[model samples]
Target: MLAIINDDLAGAGRPESIFISWLLWQPRGVDLASEALKEVQKLARYEKVDPDIARLKALFASLAGSDRSMH
Candidate 1:
């Protein structure tokens, strides 16, 4: 099961796919918060207006800025 997921991530290239890949990596000790933060900025710069995306960007910004030790 994990092997299949790894294989998919290894081949994914779409922006959303890459984001999902980063999300999956986060739980495995990978520090994806920075990447997520950058992605949020990219979305905002491009004028993406989806409320959900905006909310996600805000969440990512908060996560990226917050001290991890507190969590």
Candidate 2:
């Protein structure tokens, strides 16, 4: 499943890549947070609005916060 998402991510555009990153993060949690964050940053660079982007941002933030608390 993750390998499939990574393959899709490699060919996806900014928005689609961001969505794919979120999919990559779902089962993996903090391990994939940086990948998702990179995608989010790429999307932010375009100054575009995506209905699902906010959810991705929230998910990354939530994961980051949890990851930090673990250390």
Q: Best-fitting candidate, measured by TM-score?
A: 1
| lDDT of each residue in 8-68, candidate 2, tens digit only | 5455544346555657556644456565456445434332365454444555445455422
The prediction achieving the highest lDDT against the true structure is 1
The C-alpha local distance difference test score for the whole of candidate 1 amounts to: 0.50
TM per candidate comes to: 0.43, 0.33
List clash counts for every candidate, in order.
Answer: 0, 0
Model 2, runs deviating above 4 Å:
1-30, 46-48, 66-71
How much lDDT does each candidate structure score?
0.50, 0.46
Per-residue lDDT for 65 in model 1?
Answer: 81
**For model 1, how does the per-residue alpha-carbon lDDT over 1-71 read when each residue is reduced to its tens digit?**
01112345455543345445557666665577676566556656533555444444565565578532111
